[model samples]
Target: MPNKHLFFLLLLTAMALALPSYYFDSNSIRFIFFIGVVAIWRYLWALQHFIRALFFLKVKFKRLRQQEQAIGEIADPKHIFILVTSFRIETDTSILVYKSAIAEAIRLKQPVTIIASIVEPSDERLIKQIFYNSAPPLRVSLKLVRIKGSGKRDGLAVGFRAISNSQVDLESAVVAVVDGDSVLTENCIKNCYRFFSINPKLGALTTNESCELTQSSRTLAIYRRWYNLRFAQRHEFMCSVALSNRVLTLTGRMSMFRGDIVGSSEFIDRIEFDYIDHWRLGRFRFLTGDDKSSWFQILKDGWQMLYVPDVKVLTIEQPPHNNFIKGATLLMVRWFGNMLRANTCARQLPRVVMGSYVWWLLRDQLISIWTSLFGLVLAIMGGLYYGETIFYAFAFWILLTRYLLSALLSTLHGHFSLSWPILLYFSQIYGSMVKIYVLSHMYRQVWTRQKTTLKDSGNRLEHFIRTFGSNIALLGSASIFLTVVAFIAGVLTTYDIQAFISYYFS
Candidate 1:
């Protein structure tokens, strides 16, 4: 089906649905049509991604495997540089991660350098012990660099500099940035290295991720499931975007990059000192999300980013706190904060520069912050005016759609659980709220895993203003969105909003 044909078909279908609502006099019918249309589009979004990702997973991987050189048969494999940042990571997880990386390097039969960036002397010793115990061949070496506990960005900069300065061939070599807690599975590199080998314009690529939770607590268990579901969804989203030769983020967990781009001075500078010029906040320095900087640089320079759905990176899970609600809220604050900050910058790119679909994806992130909560607010308002039956009807509809959505996600990971539906709703509603809160306070940064924050001076008046402004903005936006939702639910009229706006602005 061509895009032109598909677009016309969809437009006609929408027109047909709207005719009934135009004829019907009841708000009940209109609200039903609204909900139905929203659900249809949501499923359509999922359906397209499922098809795109499936094509890549089934078709692309098979074709690449058939055409590309075998793992050990390449004529001249590039020098592999694995940069692992292990700040405050558990010792056991560190050993497992480094040991697996060393094994992969040794297996490659190519010259490899592993740079371990850490602030702890013990971790340095531990990594060294693993290196020596493996007794890697002469082709393998270790470069230990210590940082001042600044952040992952600084650690990565130091490691990247080491690689950039080496005698290796910058054009053909490869760099892998791995978190301390993420372990490489067997053949992870073998599966991904071929993509960069085949595609000359490929600047970087990221692999699928899976979390390994060792704790037995029930709260941690639920969180583990939530993390797994997120990764599953991430796999599909990354694959779909990669079809356009671009990914939103290269992923900080573990992503491979072309050696030349990774070593470039401009690339390093972008990641190390990335900042956004805000109209209100002046210059907002990035406290995290180095991966976004890297992705944006590649996108701007006309390079490709591939998502290797077959290669999986295992991350050792660590809960931010014992209480799930508090931990989840804080984690969302950081995640959405990073997203909104980077997204705001990306949306400013011209359509010609970013492409239409890619730019739409960034713009949709802001629109979704409001639309996600619309149905919920509508349901509550409908119940207040109509009856309990209206709320029950909406509740049933929500549960069905969420469950079906979660079940469809199994196509990515081939696993489904009863908890996914519940978590999906939790994520949608809670995540939207977090995005709203973080939108107004994106300048304030914090790291979830490490207790890190943006360096700032202590000033009571300035801090109070910042806090007050965020609250006012959040409340104002919520009030406006709720008002709109209420109007759609027929609880409020156009005159009501017009009068309020006139009074407020007047």
Candidate 2:
């Protein structure tokens, strides 16, 4: 069905169910009212984030247009450094990224230095060939830095050190870090540079990301495509966060920084040896999440970070495993692990330093995992006891609210498809579960890209207890809370808890 038709159908269906009380008794009305309250709370929470996102987006584009109109007034950087890092990268992806970088360089019409950080000599040769074959208009200068196949952090450190040693004018140069699989948009540099020109305090800026799905299976493709769309939605939240002079992560896929900042020894040190002092796991080394380390360093230095929503990078996303569930699980484990590790110390920063809103976001990370599950579990239990009315109402509420949100987001982000509402539910429920597991096993870190595993120190039994204990406690607590709520609801509706329980369970 067409999006327009489907949307209207959803709207009409929602309207049909809007007056459920008219069709049911007073008890049913109360139950529906309770569900409505919860739905409203969730909607308002999402609306707050969305509204801030829309506002920042408006501001970003306005600034972009203004900068474009007065292009001659804005001083373009003297040198633009494109740092490309690769580790056992596919030849096709490496070629695409380098080609895009060269094209972008030509468009910028600046003397561009391309630094290729590679562990495999084969990749270095391939990249060198791409640059060497580039047209004269590109004006591409190539530097190949070889590193041990250690990790992304090490590769980035090597590149940063080389940039520091180069003769580029740091004050007027911009360094962009692009992942091996990421292709830069033509206007990425132009749009990002304007921010640096406008604000000298802007330390770094990350662009919006769109993904190219590489999964062969149709099911996996659908899942990956929707996942990418949701990822775009996340950028909206980041935009709002960036307005407070803090972005949760400066994505390594493609983020630009001032040359001086990237060249500094402090920045290099952070990228090279970023670690968290875990109470249980001792000083755990950061095996991944180079992006988080960079963001933290910038944040710690009081540098302003901004999100360029208009500027986007096309990232090639390959499923880690053939099975969608397995792939998503692996990806989430790595991602949430990275986030949880960084967040441990991030929450310790002074409120003035991190901003109160950011602090709240950090706190929300801990609560939201369980809260997301709470609603679904409530609906399920309500269905079991009270029949399908509660379940149907809950589903209707999710569909109507998420579809409306998807429509609004699609208008802004352009990838919101009919599948988005379904994906939203999956992300909320399954994604929350993944986050909960990762939160418990924060010490687990793995590089899904290169199949590298970093083990947390401890015996299997100790690790199992530490990891699963939190989950058990969380479930037990939620069960007790829900039981109490159910008892109260039973009394309010049926007026006899014992009879209500017997009617359902018996």
Candidate 3:
């Protein structure tokens, strides 16, 4: 079911029933107690957000239906500026992204401006050729803007500069921003235009990304499936399902921006302008989660964010080349780091404690960190005590539970996929490990003047296995010995408190 809270409810009830035995007999029972507490916290967190998402989803859907009926026509826009931002290594899927956008550009007779910024000082001419030659018709004029830079948001600066320099009338025209790896659905542009046409209050419109799937590319395919199931699926559902009434942030992957909103100083400051004083003592570089940063800025500018899930985009994902281990590491570091940074940002904002939202966000992050830390500890302990047997059991149980929850969530909401179960399991276990790595790296970067380029592959992993393995073994051995002692005491004594021992052994 879409109600993740339901699963938590049943799960929590069982834990509650067994809580007393755990406390009395097992030293390891502390972990179980921690789990129950976290589960309750998570249930409440999901319940509140899911309800809000549902409400907004209903309101937005109804509004869109009314708008579509009123208009009774499609493919209409006076002027549109399609903004595509790029950086670092290129992907083959840019061809598809351009193809999709070009279709929209032709339909609306809007000239498309493709901002192709090369991070490594590569030729913009090659990027220009890719889009220009790929265009279905020669009539549509494509402007290419390339910049030499690194970091996630660096390309955006170049893209923004190009848009401003175009000197287009900001009030009337619409600007569409789509990532190079994302392909827009046939009606995505039309839907965006239609929604904006009907509602004057909407400042930005979002289209959900449908990750491309294929059999040949297992790594990429698995990565794509996992992303859709975990990140995009939940994120879109949050906004489209009406979990949160107000659109928090329009994703940078594929989103439409009104010209006025993009050009306005308020949006520029609030969304686009991430004033990272690199010169400041603690601040390193402007490493950012671009889409969220943009959304926060828009919210600050008093603009309504609309998520049109019907407007779909097929986005290509690049998984690590070194297989599962590399992929897990990358995912954990980026996702956890981003979440932590966002939390830090939220706390720093004025009047953060004044709103229910700030508290919700804070609680969610804290609980996530707590759960991850506890899980890691438990896994290690189990590994040491029961040897690999306990570790595998614990891992399997978590993986299965996470998979079922994610799969059920996916099926209930919409966008069903077979890979949901497998990907869900992998992401759940590996995701946590990766996050630990990222969090640790982030701390190092902040405090130790460590370069972002420092590779985490070798030394970090060795340390984790060496350290965590030892701790798990030691704790597990102690737990096992204690359980045996408790069992013997129960056999000899009439009223021995052996429930906890039995539970552990069983």
Q: How large is the C-alpha RMSD of every model relative to the true structure?
A: 6.6, 4.5, 9.6
Clashes of each: 0, 0, 18
Ranking by TM-score: 1, 2, 3
lDDT of each: 0.81, 0.79, 0.57
Summed over model 1, clashes come to: 0
Candidate 3 residue-wise lDDT, 1-506, digit = tens: 44654575466456545443434344664445334454556546555555555556566576776767678655245567777765543545655666677766676555445555455434455556666666545546677665545444656766666666676776766788877677777767766776666767667777666665432455765565566676644563446333232354467778787877777655554444453321112333335556766766655555556777556677666554437566656556655665655555554555432244544565556546545445545556555544554454454446445655554465435665655755665565566655545443442222111113423334776657644654565466445544443333232233344654677786
N/CA/C clash count, model 3: 18
After superposition, the stretches of candidate 2 with alpha carbons farther than 4 Å from their true spots are 7-33, 36-38, 68-74, 135-139, 456-506
Per residue, candidate 1 scores C-alpha lDDT tens digits across 108-150 of 7678899998989999889899999999999999999999888
Please report the candidate that would top TM-score against the real structure.
Answer: 1
TM-score of every prediction relative to native: 0.90, 0.87, 0.68
Q: What lDDT, from 0 to 1, does candidate 1 have?
A: 0.81
Please identify which of the two predictions, 1 or 2, would achieve the higher TM-score against the true structure. 1
Q: Give one digit per residue, the lDDT tens place, for model 2 in 285-321.
A: 8899999999988888888888877788999888788
Q: What is candidate 1's TM-score against the reference?
A: 0.90
